[model samples]
Target: TAGDTAGDTAGDTPEDTPEDSPVEDDISSNKKGRFHSLGVGELLVVKQKLIAYEEGEIAHIENVMKGEKRSRNHRTLHRTEEFTSFELEKEEETKRDLETTTRFELQKEIDSEVQESTKKEAGLTVTGKYGPTVEFTANAGIATEKSSSKSKNLSTSYSKEVVDRSVHRIQEKIKEKRTLLTIDEVEVINEHSFGNLESVAEHTNGIYRWVNKKYEAQLFDYGTREIFEVVIPEPAAFLRYLATNHPKEGTSIPKPQKPGYMRLYPILGTNEFEEVFIPLSPGLLTKETYLKWVEKYNIQDVLPPPSSFIVTSIAFAIDPVDTGVEDEGDGSLTPNWRTVNMKNTELVVPPGYVAKIGTLSLAIFPLHRFILRGLFGEIAIGTNKHAFHQGGGIGGSETFVLSNETGLVPVAFSLTTKQFFSGTLEVQCRRTEEHMEAWQISTFNAIMNRYEVLKEEYEESISGEELFGSVDIQGKNPLENKSIILNELKRQVITQMTRQTFDEFDAMREGVLPEGFPQQDVDEAWSEGQYVRFVEQAFEWENMQYLFYPYFWGKKKDWPVNSRLEDTDPLFKSFLQAGSCRINIPVRPGFEIPINIFLSTGEFPWDSGEGGIAVENEDGEEERDIFLSIAEELKAQQGAVYFKSDGTVFHANEDLESVLTGDLIEEVNDDGDVVLNDDGEPVLINGTNFLEDDINREINIGGKIYMIIAVNEEQQKITLDENISIQESVQYGIGAKAIGVPWVVTVPTSLVMLHDGNKLPEIPEAP
Candidate 1:
């Protein structure tokens, strides 16, 4: 109704509002004298205008000061002109600052207006006969561009026929869900429920094979027949024989009468004088005095001497009747009655070992008896035949190295026996050697001997008949050869041995060595190449012991080491590169081993018979059906259009019904001139009216004919009513008559492949 008169403002002359005035002279002259010449009515009008402006209700402004009278003197006018000139300059600066401050405030009001207008809820009416007589209005929830003579409306309700058609379309879409070949081809059959389910063959057995390719590759790379071993002394040994005799030759020593003891001859070449004794007391002589004794007795002249001439024993008196014999009243005693009790006995020297008189203070059955107290204490020396190899190198495997025939000084001495079945044998014999060597020559000799054989073999292979053959090597000793090849071999051996030793020590320190190994021996022998190489080879073999010995019983077996006259490539070079010994074993190719053993005994591991547990269907047919149903529902939703509450007519992928009301679709700038793309095609703007290609055609709108104008594919907007004169241009919103194109929304099925009983399937051929 009010819109019928809205066009009048465009042509009507401006009129003065009450607010289009200035201030009164009395109030303005007090401070702001710029409005000092205002009348009473003008003052009220200015006050009202200022108040309305501040309240944000000011709608229109009229030419309030236009065609008004003015009066000013020449001096006041000159002063005003000067002040205006200065104020003009200052205003330029102030305008920049004011623009920044008011920009956000002005933008907020514009944004709110745009949002409110987009709702298109408010009604507009142009009550003038110059425009169209019929007033078409877009209902709500759909904003439209400003139009004078044309409008469009989307229907809020559909006819019963339209609803029935929509329902039929939805059902058809659901029926189309089963047409998908992917879903149709999927096996929906469940596993057999009652029969022998375990016997029902499976596609996959669920066994994961972890094939050790690295081990296989290293096992059969280089030399397949060569073997290497590092020689080391036995961990435990004893004096097998007393003289120049061998045990295997049938001259074996008689077994001891009692366990944990050994009897020795006190005199040389005399069996009757056999007794565990030494001539000198423990710690009786110092190094200087023992050397003097050596000069007096010529002890060093003999390779090994009898124990009685040098070592002294404690003479125990035995009664003549103690041997179960009557005294006969003759007062004579036989030697047989004084049998030497070697059990838990101690001597100044060890049997079968040469000693320089008092040089060594030995003990026997040291654990049970307190013999040679400090020298052979439980804490000092543990389970040993001699004190020489008691500590330091090779787990206390070091031998003795005594300079001259130095005697041992007695630091402490004791020998007292207890009654039968009363106490342990007590013999405290603490000897203080007046001498000790820095580096024993015997220890050096032992270490050198370890490499001597290897060195000789290496030299022979390099320069002997194996290599020289008919070539003249007569003038040169192969063992003494200093050829380049031998030197290189020596260098490589040294480098490899050093690296292997370092790795072993590191492993030992880090506790990465095999369980129960002695880290002490490894640490000590790490510097000696012979022992270091030995440990390295032993450790490497131990790691792959599973492959060598199928039924190993946790026993250390000697690796066969033979000197090779010819150079051969090792089968496994990778192990050698890793500073590990290559066992020179060849692996058979294409050997397939089962990942797991299935011990089938005509029975399932878990019972599935009738009195036992019931087995459900293994295949997941129900889950597949559920997923297919979900896909059908989502497909049905594709046809359901959502009318936006924000009044946005054009939505992405949305089909709209509208009538054409414009000439043709074309891109237009702010001046409304047709724009063109680079291809010379008319660019179509969105949310604008457009007509079909045939502009002369008339389109039916609500059974009324409207001239078709243009068609806009980009905006999907159709223009109509080209003949009808519109006072302004506006967008024809949703509901215009247009062709509806069918669309379907499909999604990928969220189906997962499962094993029997809906279990997560195990991956095969892992690692």
Candidate 2:
């Protein structure tokens, strides 16, 4: 009944109201309306009428309140006046009661309509605009008339089992795809032969590793003189399975030597060779008599022979023309030879007697005398000790001896021929004792013979028109000319001897010699004896050939035979050149641009060892030289970059010093110490003139070498002729030549190519 009354009141229009009504007239005149003094129940009825108006009629009421006409003839107006506090309270209470009753009735009607709609839609499907039609099945009738009860657990279990099997199959498929997409291995082949330029694609296998999200491979060739090509597959997560583990730093554990691989030793220093002595027997003389004999002989410093030794000797032969001339030379061509005199010095001469042109008798005897002091301080007896010493002791000791008994000592014999002879001259090297092996004697003989042949050829070359035409030696006498040739011959012989000695040493160490050879005994003795110490010494003096055999052997090919005296020494260079190796990387798509990294082998001149520039000033404080500081800064900024094939355009990130014209802060290591060489001298990774001499040079980086065809020192950029991919975590040793100074620096490769400022190329999804 309230709903009907409210609806009726809401439906009433201004036309429904009588025009003669006193209440309407009064409201129109005042422009505001006040409710008549009615009871709370009447007000409640009025409030319901107004609240029950439809949304469209509410706008009409609002217009009437604003005194706006809804039609041309009929006008509507509505207004409200504040009521007394007590009257307003009473009116609010009545209005709330009416609203609550009206809401309760409306809710009841909505529930009734909803029940009717549900009954009509039961067991039917309803479709929506956005989704598939869903059907609802009613089970009310079945529940009321159920006759039998059963479990549906079997059906549910079957569905669950099917789902699990489906999920497992999907996972297996994903794993299989991943495995197939992974790049396991990459192979690198030389594009051109180093020895034979026409021959191409010499296969040289190298090891590779994926570290720190980058692929790295070892280089076999020193790339300084070789071109290489690397082939790799697309990058994928599964490729990591084929990566080799990176070597840990400062690891004391020695790697297991592969079969047939020669064992290497560290370079020796001067101190290790200071007081060299050789033991009479191996393994510390277990015999009590021998020990007592050693003590009785007062042998205070007896130790096993060094793992290896370098023995040097010079042989000079004069021409009859120079030697036969009266007052010009001695009549006897045989020079006076002095032998060390010892009490029990018995010479065992092998049965071989032959005399030939340039053939001289070589007596291999110990030169140094070791005295055995008696109880009364009188020298009881003295034994001769040969000048067979370790690497660093060569030419440092007063003794100049060669004993055939010392098989491990490599004999570097030099022969100088002073005569200008046309025919071949056979030089015989016969030892006084059978202590020398046949092979050793033959080796020495072969060296002399080679020297003789070379000397003859050289003499013939210069003695003819070439010598007479030359302004420098045009009027020189035959003796003077022979002297010049002899000097050259001596140098060639020494070089040949040194090379032959190293070869023999390597052969012995590798155990590649004939079986049952005495050299085997020498090898074993050296290996079992102080071989570890020897290796350590070799490593310490890695840059010096005289101290480190392996370093010398590795760099023997690069040795400057015709270089200046200062250039022949490693200490003067300050950087060791390492052999080149190959590296392979699986790079993301769109980032396949080849990047050539140029490295310099420069170091701070002040931080150099023996022959290096001074680092400290008169005040005893380390002086910071501007040039050296620049050198140090350049070393820190050494990094890899992406370069175009044109060798002009290159890109590098901010981490690298893309611009060279800036002041740099000095860098100190974590220990607060500057980088130093083995001799504790301050050293720069890149030498002092790297920036100045960085243009147009081939640099070995991550086993690949790139020639910097063009360089922009201001922008710190370089270009290459060929493209190279940039790989993170690879080492770059850049060799650069400055103004009369050559050096090398090891740069760590860590860079990414940017298409724009701080924007990287889009990496495609792994296949």
Candidate 3:
């Protein structure tokens, strides 16, 4: 009631109106003076005064009308008419103000409603599940259902039963089969070696849920390397399998045990194989040869091609010769020992010059094996000669030209491989107006925070392990040991210093720039930080094809591409932070593509433990599930399948084939004659006649008989009970053994989809 005290009707206009208001004179004066800024409290006071003035004016007019008679009535009518227009105008202004305030309040309510609706929709799209048990709703028509033309369809072409059957068939195809192949049998089966290769294929393909069902695929050896055809369900698993099972590149040589003997020793890095040649012969090395070997040992860059060999010789000529032979011969005209000069005076030979009375000169490259020709009548095989051994013996008068008999060695030989894990994922049940902005924001925050934690842990975990080999300074010949230890310590410091510089380079790559630092400055610092070209050399040596996440088909160019993970752009980081990428596949009416399937890896750098990486857990961590719990969430919001883009549908279970043992033969009593089916051909009862078909088939031929375990009529293959062993009869054991399996068995969701009760999103037709 107090709220309605302002005014009742238009005839009794509130005093707040401009007509007959107490503040009317004050307002008019302020308007004329042009100094009319009023505070909220002052304005409210003026409004009350105006209301009082209007009430007073209405009362005065009513009194005048009552006091006068007929004569005053005429004048009163004229006055009322004149004031009516003014009163109506003032009332209209009041109504306008009231309407504006109501609209403003209504707008606030609408905004809140829209926000709440958006949240609800997002939850449904991300967490909803749809299948036979759940009803398909209109909201499921997300971005995936839209098309440019009527021909583009993104709906299931077949019934859900077909997809389920397809999944079951795949499961059966990869079903485990027991095999008992003896060592001799394995050797005989050379053309189709089903031993190791088959095992590998089975392991690799078995990890995926969709394999060996409709499409026929196999793994075979073409030369030394194994080839997989449509078999890689997850690249991370494939890489790990190869690293563990595949042979290392180089061969291991037996170490010579003799006291004075020297041999080649391979130094293994995470991504490189380096052979260190022992017992370097300083005498055989010319000045040019000495510098080249020394520079490579220290991992320094090779100087540009010498204008003349003399230039290189003169550069290192300051160092004196350290190797020579001693003479210990009987009294004879010929000298028993001759010293080989490796000094500046030992004129360097021209390129490709094989002297008649001298040794052959050949260049040795990095990561390649080479043979060394010893002047002592033995060949030393190595990459390069770094040290020398001096001895006295009967020396030959003439030098013989050495032959180039060095065998080549490949890179990464004898080095361990890096390991990682991967899997696939898909999103389902999104509505048409759905936006991924929220999901993207959440993902970026999660990943960036996780990365920060890991990075901090790595930096804090550094214990400064020395780069050089450890030497005990307290052992015998302590002084010599101390000197060696000191030199090692110095090298370690230098290495750590270089690594720190590289760390800065990494910071720059990651967009962590110094204040006021220019792009040119970063480039210059990067070049200097190479420090003899050392920056993740191990990773370079490994030569991984897809070092960073190889975003699937449509997702590749979604963001700016960076050659290395360390330099990925902001948009790419956002995608990674989101922990998912969208992929598009073709769709048809009978076939449906499930949005739950995706290809991904559970790899995040810095999470990999020190020295090398291991799977996040003994049983590799489930990747997509870690980001969002689709399994449980979908259960609550049943009957919705979400999709991000358009794609082709997959038809399920189009092939079906099975085989079992033939009916057993049994004696029958029918007038002392054998019973058979129609056509007068032995009416077999619960028995099969082998003679029915032209081709003869027998079970456990030439051996004890047992029941049939399983059969696949598509391939005419059969599995007999393990108790029975058939003899080596080609015709009898036909289609008995199971083959075609690679690596270990574990199904990836990306390659072969699991169709349980999942339904496809509905597609809207074009207008």
Winner by TM-score: 2
C-alpha positional error of residue 624 in candidate 2 after TM-score superposition, expressed in Å: 29
lDDT of 1 by residue, 458-500 (tens): 4334333333344332222322332322232333332332222
Give stretches of model 2 more than 4 Å off.
Answer: 1-519, 522-650, 653-666, 669-690, 727-730, 736-767
Work out the TM-score per prediction. Answer: 0.13, 0.15, 0.12
Ranking by lDDT: 2, 1, 3
Cα error, residue 608 of model 3, in Å, equals 42
lDDT of 2 at 248: 20
Error of 1 at 323 (Å): 27
RMSD of each: 70.3, 65.2, 61.4
Model 2, range 1-767, lDDT digits (tens) per residue? 10001001011112223425321111011011111111112000000001121111011111121222233333222222332222111111111111111111111111111112122222434443545755444332222222333332221111111100001011111111111132222222224222312244333222222111212222111112111122111111111222112212223222221111122443476232222233232222322323343343334444322222222232322222333212326533332221121121121212322111121122221121221111100111112223222121111122222223321111222222222111111222233323223333343333333433444344344333332452432123434433433233222222221111111122133334566443433322332223122111111111111211122332233344212222122322111221121111111111111101100111112221122233466789865432223343343224222222222222344344222211222335899977666787666432112353555444555466655555656554555546555533233344432122223322222212212222222455899
Score candidate 3 by lDDT: 0.24
lDDT of 2 at 616: 61
Error (Å) of candidate 2 at residue 551 is 35
Point out where model 1 deviates above 4 Å: 1-313, 318-426, 430-440, 465-594, 597-767
Model 3 TM-score, 2 decimals: 0.12
**Measured by C-alpha RMSD in angstroms, how accurate is candidate 1?**
70.3
Candidate 3, residues 1-39: lDDT per residue as tens digits? 101011111122112224243221111110010011111
Error at 672, model 2, angstroms: 3.7
Compute the lDDT of residue 700 as modeled in candidate 2: 57
